[model samples]
Target: MSSLTMMPMSLEEIAQAVQGRLVAGTAAANTPVATSAFTDSRQIVEGSVFIAIAGERVDGHDYVPHVGAQGAVAAIVDHEIADADVPQIVVEDTVLALGLLAKHNIERRRALGTPFTVVGITGSVGKTTTKDLMKALLSHMGSTVAPVGSFNNEIGLPLTSLKVNAETRFLVAEMGANHVGEIANLTSLVPPDIAVVLKVGVAHLGEFGSAERIAQAKSEIIHGLVPGGLSVLNANDEHVAAMSAFAPGDVMWFGLPNGDGGNPAITAQHVRCDELDHPSFTLKNGDGEHAEVTLGICGQHNVMNALAAASVAMRLGMSIDEVASALSDVTTISPHRMAVSTVNKQETSFTLIDDSFNANPDSMKAGLDGLLRWKAGSESQPFRIAVLGTMLELGPDEKDLHVGIGRYALEGGVDALLTVGSASDASLDALAGAMADGASLAGDASHVDWVHDIDEADRLVTRLAVEHPGAVVLLKGSHASGLSALAERWQALAAQ
Candidate 1:
């Protein structure tokens, strides 16, 4: 987590890199930009460059004047900023310009003869967690630069890549895509020395149209690798394992020992979780030297993510023991991904598993599995409640997917279920209702409930907290569901 000293880019060099024309304050073209570029004008500093992206609601060009007045050296814009005091680099598309600038930055770093390794990671799910884990493991060897949160798209990847300087030894580039060619373009911007494909689940099935298409999109990272670059594949996922044929170089497998056919270069054995659901396992490498890793993070699904990271670190010359020690030291990742917390209300307290960051069918099941493993520290069983919301972008069979998750929860012995929906959107309401119907049909009707929105869901959960002290509540859904906001509200109240 050490702060990086960004390599300076002159305003003239920036314009040439992005293929833009510098206007307004042309005298400052030689000004050395020793800081990072920003899309938000509010984050502008003395030496930073501002990228004016024309978003849907708010036009970044409107803030050009404000950023110029705040001492920004230059701004990259699609159109000329006439009144702004800072120089403007006009390009056909500001986003593309941003990518080009980042590409030049990475290439310049390489030309300086400093040793650097860029690892590109993509998958239908588990991309963010694996990125976080890899960052932790790589940081042990040298200074590392990784994106904050799930910054995996064009803008995010470039912004993260721009943070790399002469001193940085590792850059964990998280790449995500909603359709075909997105990951390929991202990989072109920052071609990885090592590529990691975690799993090929139906995360963005609606956008990509089919599972095979999703696999093809995810494989772009493997095909985009540099010459002699190694690919890390998940042996547990057949779709991902099949990508080995597209790799330009060797492939390293990581998964459970019982996975498909090939022996995983890195695997976890004897996996178990405690009452709070934090998993512990024996970390084993292909050479058979093993180390015990008791992860500080919750969820059994993360074992695969840890192994994926271990494979990369071991390939980069870190010992198996070093990888295990680093993995054990990581207590949490980006917020709301199986983040466990204790909420204390007026007279009762409950365990809250906030996996409300984002979800698909695969991740929803993983969240419920973590909830089912939770214990309340008494002889009697703990009351388990799952508060799920609409999982968007699931395509024509979205209802069937929601229903399947609800059935999975009830059949797996969940005590209660609350599905959140939008009172304003009937389509969303129907999806939530479908989940309720599935749970009721699978178990007792009295245990299933569908609330119109987060507000109503909150009231019911509050009452349930008072009635069932020490209950374990799980909040999971897509980002638009606002479930993470609800989790934050409860967490703030608990803190107070």
Candidate 2:
């Protein structure tokens, strides 16, 4: 990882920025900060500032001594750290203080009078992928900073923003929220010059209560944009396209052609996926500029994500051809997002599509679509299996949503379906069973089964690998579903 480019500041100056009181090791108040702030004590570098956040399981204050020994110049704490070797900045809330410090860093970068663009992205789905694509596209122009994964929450967004400095040209700030006002709070730290709203779906419907409420929550990013900032929206999604009304400045649309004579400002024409499910299309702009884009990544769903990233890069002076070339160079994104690999078990190799980083109704169907698109190399008859986990936070219709996925998978040509859940959580297990039942209703009951946990699921998959030598398996679920861990286990086994 590159060293953080945050400008150096005295410990006392940091204290004033976060509105904290400087205590302990007062003589070191004049010391210059050598690194940016960090929340994890293990990541602390010399002269770094540590923010001590109190969580339910563990309090960050417990690691203060450890960070001090690691040469952290100071620790920001909710209360005093009396016996610490380094200076302590006491504040009322460490998390809030961390956000304040990030805000201060952004303000400092702006004060240098250097060129910088902060692109904020938020939506129910596609935030991380879009962020990754934007980072790759923008890096071709100048230095770019973005989160590692889906680090778009309050804490993650601030930690990512603290990496920016005077020389950094682009900051792709991904904003995510489980409830209202979360993105608004994140935008206050680093208000974006270009805000991208990908799509409005029910990823966290249980928290927000309705799709309309989710749309309202997603619109906060547009509302939080800097004065005269640009808003990039998805034209295919009605909810997101409606957000254009809330933009203070201009709005740019990106999507597949609707075939009704209306075209998004940025769109994919003649889009089609190959035998491996990799999409190829002609990237077209409203100005009549076009480029052929055969994405190195899999999934037809990614076309809109590519268009969204291309919109921001083109807005920042990157030509259409440059954007297409950079986008094609990206072969993968953060792990478990339509990530394809060939794993060998007992000398029989099977294809694995690990889209298990997270899941919802929309993403689950997309994964199934990808699975249906896969074509076996030489096998006259290939079995396609889908290992799906529970989709949480779909409001009161959660069960119905799970059932819909199961029915859709089976009706859409999935050969085998396995729904996984933990035995400890009967409710989740029941939801898993509901999916199997839906599949049974759509097809054969013997073709569907619900497993109690990953261990049982693994046993079943291993047996299937033996019975069917060349099967394509897809693992799709939320993080709590443990399917990603299963994917990792199989991947590790393949390596050995």
Query: Which candidate's TM-score is highest?
Result: 2
Worst ten in a row by lDDT for model 2 = 26-35
lDDT tens digits, residue span 1-496, model 1: 2253356788888889999998856565665564678888887777788999988999899998878678678889998877887888899999999999899989988888878999999988898999999999999999999999999999999989988888889999999999899998998889999999999988888898999999999999998999989999998888998999878999999999865555677899899998888889999898989999988899999998989999999999999888888888999799899988888777678888999999999999999999999974557878898999989888889999999988999999898899998899898889899999889889887878999988898888878888887788999998888798999987886677
Clashes of each: 0, 0
lDDT score of residue 283 within candidate 1: 90
Give the TM-scores of the predictions, in the order they appear. 0.97, 0.98
lDDT of residue 30 for candidate 1 = 66
- Note the Cα lDDT for every prediction shown: 0.88, 0.89
Runs in model 2 with CA error above 4 Å? 376-381
